[model samples]
Target: MQNPPLNEILIGDCREVMKTLPENYISACITDPPYNYEFIGHKWDNSEIQRRIEKVSGKGNKTLVKNIPYGSGLAGGVRNKKWYQRNRHNILDYEKWCFEWGEQLFRICKPGATVLVFNSTRTVAHVQVSLENAGFYARDMLVYKRSSGIPKGVNIKQQLEKKGYEQPEKWDGWHSCLRNEWEAICVLQKPLSNNYLETLLEYGTGLFYAKEQFGGFQSNILEGIQRDKTEDFNVHCTVKPISLMRKLVEIFVPRLENSILIDPFTGSGTTLLAAKELGINYVGVEIVPDYLEIINKRLDGISGLQGMLPLSE
Candidate 1:
């Protein structure tokens, strides 16, 4: 099938949805897929958590709830009451799902197309191996880092309470040990007879926007872009930061002049929005209805997307 409407959101499983598209249709894919665990939540909803926080501090204080979700580290493990059991159908089948979807992804991607899959330390190896076995070449393994200036939260109130202070000040909430970022971007490229430059030409349409900002070293490992909840989707699964997505597009899948970006696991449509800002075409498939709504709202206020058509057509 021809790809869905450009700039629109398709609500469905990516594995099933991507199969409908034509081969070699996408120039590249920038994805932050679900981590196979249901606990990760749909798209990082921390409003309830923030509300609790604000209640703890005073309703009028914005600073008190600022870091409620992103905190000093990745949020706690996703808690699904039925996760470990086999009674109900769960995406937690981990390796099986990884390999199955990895194969599907391999099939859909164009030859020499680049894919950047983001994951945490725990499942990084599984993702890497699955992709490799499915025939994608692993080009690089890079960490997404945060600045050392930021504090962590491994131990805040306990230390302060031990010292006889009733409560550790908010700044004290910053963990002394800088929190290592939770996600890693594993870059892969499909094998092709054509040269790498040809592949770059096909994908680098919007790369110019981030090239000069990289300070000479074209390292794939990125750092310090915090996910702002205010600008983020409230879905349970953690969404990747838009700045990080922009850099990923520029560095890996440079925008192709005539082609559209495709994101199968388009959580909250971060990839689509990034494509919009870069003046590229895009198709996003989201499995969750709430996330699709979030994507629409995000696209609505973007001035550049004023006349763009939704991919759901």
Candidate 2:
């Protein structure tokens, strides 16, 4: 099949759109799907807090409150009500949905294509199970550590104090949950042929660029700060930093001149932008029309990004 013109964002359900493309056309996939954690806060929420802190401190504000009480003070009423209805299903149902999409993803990728999926720590195991059940080989897991994170859960010490009970000094450290500082990215691959070199020659997939990884070797842990909402970039709530996305793309498609990357859940087009910056072809599928608008604006702002066209085009 002739390579289709990519570098465009398709506004529709990914499962439906992926079916229209030719089989084994995608070289690699790097995407971040919903973790089924209900209505969890994203990078935009955190950035708002940082903006407020800077406002009070004037500049160079390093200190941040250890904990912020839920519903007490925060933007959007301390929680994302929009996400509440979407993630009401239980874990079992969520995993089943994961399997449905995983099967489709496996069908579209080449023989030895790579797939990198980001999930919350709680649901990483389920995601792995879904992918493995869909016939993708389980590779090593990658960890992305963030420099800052907001801790959530009930404060036992504070509750006891409010109830007029004298708690021991050692109880100061007690809480229902710990601060989340990292997220898990499950690495997976389609089964390759016995001879890797022959597989690469036939399918144009099957190897990782060892030398292109950060610091020579590709460690499981990738450390980076989150992307803040700047004048040119901020559109989605859970936007990842371009630097991190670029690294993942580079590792997946070392020979970018002939490869095409697919982002199934292209929120605000961060992955697409990364592909454009690296001078490669890409296809992004977004369900929300609002997000598609954001993707268009972002792509338009990027200089020298060829094949820039509207969704209708």
Candidate 3:
């Protein structure tokens, strides 16, 4: 409630931690929390796999798993014992948990505040319903186009053929199956008694630079920074690029100089780091202790940030 000592991470459950904060304390909330999908938890190393990539052939190629932070990956295999337990039972359980948090978030944010929630196709509809029920109006959906890279050594098609499976002669985009190239970013706002669109439009129009760079930005969706993040722990859980958040804040809330940006489920604190870099104040809440530590270390590494006890110069 006492602002939790600026630039420091609060390591605890968001719902409980949020209770210590004042009502309408933040100007905006941007986050990508756990979706109910029970996403696989390990990264796939396809370096030894074969590929027939054509579209991205001319582009600067980088290995999909290279340079990514360790400990983050997809969900699959029995090794994900802990994940299986946490996400067992009915699918609705996950959605219910999200709704509970959504309500809490709505209560803490200022009126006319913006909340950006990122989710997958499997859970986007449920998230939409949850946000609406929480009293926030659905504003836009931003889409980030990604390029899935190929592995180096093994022959996946050949392996399938050898197994007597029907393998297609040509491979289409990743999404033709279950592989996703873009994620849905649901934007919501706590409406003002009067016209809310004035501020909404002002925020939307401000993202023109990113719109122009990534083509035109859409109210419901927009393109994202193209990169492979399967190896990055902070990015492994269907995370949105910091670049995207940077653009969104820069365009929609240019005067963050005096506003507080809150991310209740601050996984790796990407939003917090972005806000500090942009000279905007921020408060974050994370359910995992290690994640909070990661954010603290990240903030300490930021040189321009002041009025905080940074671990490093």
lDDT of 2 by residue, 3-101 (tens): 554888887777788877787878889998876553233222335545545554754523332222223233124357643443344456778778887
Residue 207: error of model 2 in Å?
1.5
Reference-based TM-score of each model: 0.66, 0.77, 0.65
Model 2 scores a C-alpha lDDT of 0.73
Who wins the TM-score comparison?
2
True-vs-predicted CA distance for residue 69, candidate 3, Å: 19
**RMSD in angstroms, candidate 3?**
9.8
Task: Please give, for residues 1-313, the per-residue lDDT of candidate 1 as tens digits.
Answer: 5434666777787777777776666667778765544323333334544454656575564432323333322233444554334313333445556677677777866777777888765577777887888888887787887544233335766667678886477546565365554567787777763665565455332222234554676655676677756564455445667887777766655444555678877877777877887767788987766676788888776655233322211
Q: List where candidate 3 sits over 4 angstroms from the true fold.
A: 1-6, 39-89, 149-179, 197-221, 224-240, 304-313
Candidate 3: count the clashes: 21
Better of 1 and 2 by lDDT: 2
Task: Give Cα distance to truth, residue 191, candidate 2, Å.
Answer: 0.9
The reply for model 2, stretches above 4 Å from the true place, is: 1-5, 39-89, 168-170, 212-215, 225-228, 303-313
State the weakest 10-residue window (summed lDDT) of model 1: 304-313
